[model samples]
Target chain A: MLHSFTIHRAAALLRAGEISATELTAAVLDRIYAVDNAVKAYLTLLPEVALAQAAAADAAIAAARAAGTLADLPILTGIPLAIKDVITVAGVRTTCGSKILESYIAPYQAAVVDRLAAAGAVILGKTNTDEFAMGSSTENSAYFTTHNPWNLDRVPGGSSGGSAAAVCADECLAALGSDTGGSVRQPAALCGVVGIKPTYGRVSRYGLVAYASSLDQIGPLAKDVTDAAILLGAVAGYDPRDSTSVDLPVPDYVGVRDQGAGDRGLHGLRIGVPREYFAPGMQAEVEGAVRAAVELMAELGAEVREVSLPHTDLALPVYYIIAPAEASANLARYDGIRYGLSAPADSLWEGYRRTRGQGFGAEVKRRIMLGTYALSAGYYDAYYLKAQQVRTLIKQDFELALQDVDVIACPTSPTTAFRIGEKVDDPLSMYLSDVFTLSLNLAGICGMSMPCGFDAAGLPIGLQLIAGAFAEATILRAAFAYEQATAWHKQKPAPG
Target chain B: MSLTIAEVEHIAELAKLGLTDAEKALYREQLSAILDYAATLQAVDTSAIPPTATGLPLRNVMREDAVRPSMPREDVLANAPDASEGYFRVRAVFESGD
Candidate 1:
């Protein structure tokens, strides 16, 4: 029962003196111990560390209340949060789901980890991800695959699969996931939870192992929109440590959400239904559910209209080129000379070769090789440069569309959670799984994936609400309205 | 364009990854297919557009040239596979093909 509480409800209980942080954390750790063997949501569970943090949070909260300074109590005090393996946690092993850093402990805290720690959030543990956050399925993880909580045989989606499954199964109050392309939203969609990928620069990328620098963002995954909004408020602010972090004020997302909307809906909101997002091969169930959701929005007093993003067809090609190009460069740092796995060799060059050759997984190697070719001499102008130009066009398409509509509505993925290993062999098919959610990252804008409906098999379908840069408030507001009107967000999975 | 095994091997080498013969062959097929799919971009008429290296239009980001607390030596060497005397040991890198 404690594990099922959202961040808001859990915080309320802690403040009301009805529950101690230590007791609440023990309940969550118990849940992880119970279901994580089948779910495999965590790479490592920091139970001793979590319990210590819980005791500290309980003590601090009690001190604040006794001093009659309850208002000074940290918002995240006692809240349990899961960190994806890709994020650095000082003094904790951060593998990035890759053997290259399998036993590597982070030397320093990531910007987000520092912010969360300052807020007194209890760090439950590190969740799994694609090795180096490359593949769309957790199958790419060097260690194991994370099964969807809905069906034990199906994938939870990835490379944030572990975080998504963790939240969906109530193993943690909420989790942090990094999105480069659809890593956050796609997995959340598949697992039937609320996931947000804030505008590219909204959250700092420092200490988030770079997959694709330009596209990477850190955001929250939660059971409901309000909890996501609350979690977002805690860690989102300009950090001078991250040069690319935008120097803009982070809004009180939870505050705006609780402020009454007179109509209990998004009145006067304009939602654009992109025709291109509903491509020919999209599953009929997904299309029907997303269409029905738009209809519900129309009934909720929001204006729905059809729009086209012509370059939508170019997104996959463009993403494949740009992301790998950046990854190839970023990942070059894992030389045997620095940190991580190193193979002894006769020469330093051979050392670099053997270390990388043995350290990386299949998908990681494929991207690196493809990227090396794309950025190589004589091919740069044709492939890499061309993809960049197309990327500009893709960003412009969203910029122009948002001028007419407040948000773009579409399905998060083309299908529900497919069986594990179904698309693992076909890299192209796996790459195409995030067709609907990729362009938002390219445009460097905000987006949220919330449960819209489910298919015949009971697997969840996600409705994606994408907004302009720094428009997380609008995205959260619209998502909250829809979430309250439907019972989907409240649905819990039968944990394995 | 189809990639030959030799070409795959060459690309793998350029990426500092030592691939086996089988890996080269497998990559030759997979990379060819991915590249062929990427060749679809050539059909778009984009001669007039400029490239976007980053999603945001970032200017030259600069800060004061000041020193800050750096990672401690022990922490920096915490995960190194080979380390000694406050430094990382590696095969000699600058022996000019002697």
Candidate 2:
């Protein structure tokens, strides 16, 4: 019964009294208990808290019924959600998949969490992430790696891998994820779910642990486009607490849920296919799947054309330099003195040294060092400053291209999820996997990934749709339309 | 393009992450490969272009200066590793000359 119900469907059932919020919450918890051991999606589970929230939601629904105030409301009233470990939930452990923060409980809820709670959404638990949201796969998590539900041996992308995998595995109805550099979309692509990375500042970041502060944006992961929309509507808005949050009006996300491909499906919608994105060495299956999606868009009435982002080649390099430089600065606040892990040592400096040395995972420490070097005195101008210049050109490239197109389409990842330990030894190869998706972060644009097709191994392939700044509606409309035309998103991985 | 052990140590120090010899060697190898791959950006030229730090067009957004109610001290220290009497406790910093 739980397997077939999405957030919208479950919410309707709960509102109609066909199923109580307690029953819905129990079903999701049962699914988590049954499958999470093999999938390893959740980092922490608070069943008592979840059930308590479910009870509260049930009472709220009952009171609203008595007052006749439940006529028209949000569609996610009683749905369950999994929060990425990077986002704070008051009283829950927000580890960021790092040992340094492993025991650190959040003192206050993130703005997103507060909004979701206000909308009557129940947070089941916190999901795993790369330590400080640093890696391309969940293997970087200090606690545990999230396996792809499709094939337990393969990685579910990172650093929001657990959020993606949890939704894919039906561990939660919808989950929140953050994208610094394709963390949300790439993981969604790998886990075979719909994930959206709202435009920079489109969603508030207050209470979200800082990681590459300028690039990180929190968004949603869900089983389908409508579910993603419902979740986004609840969390996307301005917050006075978050200085970077945009003050733009929140659109009616669910209002446009059924917007199918219009008469000019592909005809008037200029879709750009950057040659740089389809470079040599890209997996044949990935390229084929994305091209097939473009063709499907054309059949639906959209216009497709080859476009050039001449500076595309510089994106990954610039992203690595700038993201790490920011990370180094942002992560500096985590010393033994403040919170979480602390190691005993002879002196204060030694204690700070030993704590971080023992607390941070290898990949995280490596990145901090690299980022620090890039921003250091003698090398700052050459590395950090130069990277910033290239970041601008990357943005200019997008601005130039968007002038001629409505949205850009590409493969979410260069290839599908790789074996868990395949590139763990080679950081460059791992970073290159994000080549197609990083530019969106640097440009502060919104992008989403939906299951397009499956490779020969039955692994899911994701087609990425990127829109210009604050153009989420256009992207969501197109993705929702594409999803309506296809059944790829309906295919689920067989239980391990 | 490969980074040396000493360079890795220097970077680690700059980053404030204390690394042991074993970790430093490992990072030296890893960072070298990453830096080598990142060097691909050097081929692109941008002599006249200005660096962009953000994507939004709006800047210099300021709010009226006003004080607001703050969180309770207990709530603020609920997760601190070391706290006492509504204050964050930390090791005392010594004067550099001392």
Best by lDDT: 1
Off by over 4 Å in 1: none
Fraction of true contacts retained by every candidate, in order, equals: 0.82, 0.68
Which lDDT tens digits does candidate 2 get at residues B14-41?
Answer: 6667888889888888888777777776
Over the stretch A1-496, how does candidate 1's per-residue lDDT look in tens digits? 8999999899989999999999999999999989999999999999999999999999999899999987778779989999999999999999999999988989988999999999999999999999988877799999999999999899999999999999999999999998998999999999999999999788888889999999999989999999999889888988888888998998989876675466677788999999999989998999999999999988888999998898999999999999999999999999977799899889899999999999999999999999999999999999999999999999999999999999899999999999998998899999999888888898899998999989999999999999999999988778877877899998888876
CA deviation > 4 Å runs, candidate 2: A259-267, B95-97
lDDT of 2 by residue, A1-496 (tens): 6734799888777778889888889999999988999999999998999899889889988888888887655566778889999999988888999989978988788999999888888889999998888988899999888999999999999999999999999899999999999999999999999999999999999999999888999989999998998888889999988888899999988776444534524446788888889999888999999999988987877788888898888899999999988888888888877688878776677777888888888888878888988888887877888888899999988999999989899999999999999999888889988998899999999999999999999899999999898889888877876888899988988656
Cα deviation at A240, candidate 1, in Å, is: 0.9
In candidate 1, which residue pairs clash? none
Worst 10 residues of 1 chain A by lDDT: A255-264
| Cα-based RMSD of candidate 2 | 1.7
Best by TM-score: 1
Docking class of 2: medium
